[model samples]
Target: MQTPATPKFTTREFRDVLGNFATGIAVVTSRDTEGRPVGCTINSFASVSLDPPLVSFCIDRQAGTFAAFQSHGHFALHFLAEHQEEVSRRFAKAGEDKFGAVEPVAGIGNVPLLSDCLAHLECSVYQRIDAGDHVLILGRVEAFSSRKDLPPLLYFRGRYARVASE
Candidate 1:
């Protein structure tokens, strides 16, 4: 069957529309073969399934961490706490020492898990697919932990926000 044509929007318009959806921020981190830490700030992480314990996140096609994440075989996803905006900014910067300003612990096969996140997941890459300008990486969850007292950092409308309790 032929695909139906969808209305197209400018990149800025598209971003604005997508920004309306609130998402939790996370840093997806892995080490290169040389053991150098590589990571990127990601807002596209989500639970894919529970039966087999799978999760997924999107990495931009041009991100510096893409190759390392693909070749490293394993990685850790640290869910940012509301107070960790600096950590997110550090990871998002290009050509900067992301780990220098933060503390990380090697866990689950040497993947670096940032200290004091709201939660973290250590995973092994299970599958990958190219989609538009990003690659969707599916990981099989190997380990995970959460802190009950922490609130998550949220991204919405191109800004950071906290989820307020009613």
Candidate 2:
């Protein structure tokens, strides 16, 4: 008789394994009280529903941008293109001026959208659920726009990659 395979993995191991699934990179931006831009690179973004237009992403509790996102009540998610890896790295880094070196335009109530993203979504905070080590943020999509010519920036296997056109 053939035996079925058994799986054995830790949380970190599972995360690393799941990282093989390529995802589009995004910069989730919000304005601080002083109206300064705060952004973070998030690969966890996903579309939730179409009827009500909902989207979701997870923010690490320890991330520097967490407070800004929490207090702002609104945010802009800019899905980066394959060429925007530098932009993604800039936002992902700590203690760096993410917007200082990049030109961003104000969209949908002063939310800053990176100039050349594949798509931009302006959203309002809908709800938050506390998960271990991360907070899942649900946003009500207020407005959105996209560019047909752009291809999404992809992340997989701990690196940034691009999709090749057929």
Candidate 3:
């Protein structure tokens, strides 16, 4: 087999290219060992399977909430509504109280569930895959809720965006 040539683009270049594809914003929340709510914003979430009801998201290894997610083994993924850009920005920051302003309800495994999202998925960690600079967390959906009437919060080109209504 012939070896493939290395890409000429830098990491920033690749990431900029990837920004062309729009994605929904989600806040993944879980409790630390002390039972305190911990969460972070993610745009890389996707449904993996239907029969088993699996969803997956990538967490940066260096994130503040990475340890909580690795140890807790359960979490709630909240798909933010179009008006929740501040919610997304809040969780995206590091080393601050993420749940201080937001109200949280206890979920399965005591994961923190954020209110007013377009959708919510309560899940248990099904598998963890080690990927470059990040860990892929595969979760088995235990419970879920959604509101089809709400438009989704989207991220595109490193900025929050909204979908056009017909």
Candidate 4:
């Protein structure tokens, strides 16, 4: 199939288009070279493959903790619940102590896992794909658990939103 010509659009326009779709928020955690904790909030988490039990999340190559995530073979994906907006905001900030106050416990492969999240996914890096300005990290899921009772935190159209239960 022939590819369509690139459309004329600005970065904001592109972001606006993508932002129309709602996605769950997650905090991806890993350790630095010295075993120091590192992480950031991301909305790009998704299931990649079921047969191999793989999941993927995209991280900006220019993010401060991208190097730490790239260096480590394992990391944890914590799905933020509706009540954990503070956790999302905390991790999203640059130059701030994302884990300064909260102490996380080690999960599979010594990766840090946050508490009270809707779910936790412990994974080892399965593959790394460079996609434009972001790095797609495909992880081989070693273990995962979720709280079925909580509503997940979501992002849509440049702001936070929720699913209203009927």
lDDT by residue (tens digit), candidate 1, 1-166: 9898785878899899999999999999999889988888999999999989999999987887878977888989999999999999989898888888666888887988888899999999999898889989999999999999988999999999998897
Among all windows of 10 consecutive residues in model 3, the one with the lowest summed lDDT is 96-105
For residue 1, what is the lDDT in candidate 4? 100
Q: Rate the local accuracy (lDDT) of all candidates.
A: 0.91, 0.89, 0.94, 0.94
The digit string of per-residue lDDT tens for model 2 on 83-113 reads 8999999989998888886878887768888
Candidate 2 lDDT at 91 equals 89
- Alpha carbon deviation, residue 145, candidate 2 (Å): 1.0
Instruction: List the pairs of residues colliding in candidate 2.
Output: none
Off by over 4 Å in 3: 1-6
Q: What TM-score number comes out for model 2? A: 0.90
TM-score-superior candidate, 1 or 4: 4
Output the TM-score of candidate 1: 0.94
Model 4 lDDT tens row, 1-166: 9998887998899999999999999999999999989999999999989999999999999999989988999999999999999999999999898898898988998988999999999999999999999999999999999999999999999999887987
